[model samples]
Structure formats: C-alpha cells, structure tokens
Target: MDNQYYCNRCDREFQNFNAIKSHYSDSHKKTLHYACSTCYQCFETEAALATHRRNNPGAAPHQREPKAT
Candidate 1:
C-alpha cells in the first residue's frame, strides 16, 4: 500500500504515522504518562499531556509519576 505505516513490533498496518507511533508507544512500549491532578486528565503520550499543561499553565502535576521499566 502507498503511504502506509507499519509497526515494527506488531507488524500492524496504519494509514498514518501518528497511528503507528501511538500504537507502538502505547501497546508495545507501554510508556504511561501521569494525568493532571487538578483536572485529572490522562493522555496516551507525554507530549499530549505536556501540550495540555502548556496550554493550561495552572494545571498541577500528578501526584504519582510513571515508573521506569
């Protein structure tokens, strides 16, 4: 297929790069990100939560940080 993104870990095909990246990061890597304390918002990736914090400067960090594997 043209312009397809396939996961190296699971060999799954995706139409876009973000889908493949998210799939690998979430399913394979299992890199969990803590959600915001105040609003309690969780995201699939750290960058997503970082963007949220950047947009909302008042957002407080989660009490429990993600453990390193």
Candidate 2:
C-alpha cells in the first residue's frame, strides 16, 4: 500500500508522493497568490472571500442575510 498525506486547506487528495509535495508548495504552503488587493486580506481561495467578509465586517457590504417572513 502507498502512504500519502491529505490537505484539508485546499480540499485536495493526492496519490503520487511528488504530486502531494508540489501541491503543498504551490497551494497550501504559500500565501502569495491568495491575497486580496482591496483590503490587503489573505485567503486561500474564493471560498475564503466569505471568511474575509466576516473578519472585516465594516470594510465591505454585509453578506446577504437570510430572508424572513
């Protein structure tokens, strides 16, 4: 059996050892690309946009609230 590690941050699974290593170097290890210029906020992906929104509540418009009757 082959042994491999998983990355929860990127939500990716790897098979080859080299692939896993490179994925970490390119995605998980670095925060160079995942940055927001407007607020100087760092994020891993677009999904992280929501997290930034939470942190800087006054910086941007509030997230759409759930509708109520």
Candidate 3:
C-alpha cells in the first residue's frame, strides 16, 4: 500500500507523517530571509521578526517588574 510519506517539495521519503511534516516545515516552509539582531534567530519574513520583537521586547537585563498587589 501507499502508506509512506514524502516531502512534497523535495520528494524525500519518510515513513512517519509527523517526521515528514517537521522536515518540510524546518527545511522548506520558509525562505529564511529575515533574522533577529538581538537573538540572531531566523524568520521567514520581516513581519514575523517584528512580531517576535513586540512579544519579547527584551525589556531589561537582570530586571523584573513589581508583583501586583
């Protein structure tokens, strides 16, 4: 039977569906055109990097906010 999984982009063979999915996502999902300057993490687009920065913000080094009363 045709139970095997393969990468749609590269045609690489895989037996498990999740493995192939991850492989595709990591290897082929994005073009990797953008990267974060602070963390040097890669992203597929500028919007993604902007979103990451907005979410993380890198507020402060070794600093914390006061606990709510």
Best candidate, lDDT-wise? 1
What are the candidates' C-alpha RMSDs?
10.8, 14.4, 15.3
lDDT of 2 by residue, 13-67 (tens): 5554345446756776643223333343334455676676766767655333222
Candidate 3 regions off by >4 Å? 1-26, 59-69
Q: Write the per-residue lDDT of candidate 1 for residues 1-69, one digit (tens) a residue.
A: 565644544667776545555676778874434444445444556676677688898766546445334
lDDT of each: 0.57, 0.47, 0.50
If scored against the real structure, what TM-score would every candidate get?
A: 0.41, 0.32, 0.43
Work out candidate 1's RMSD over C-alphas: 10.8
What does candidate 3's lDDT look like per residue over 1-69, in tens digits? 244654435767665444554565688863444434444444445676578678887733221112212
lDDT score for residue 32 of model 3: 43
Report the Cα lDDT for candidate 1: 0.57
Better of 1 and 3 by lDDT: 1
Candidate 1's displacement at residue 64, Å, is 5.2
Extract clashing residue pairs from model 1. Answer: none
When 1 and 3 are scored with TM-score, the better candidate is 3
Candidate 2 residue pairs that clash: none
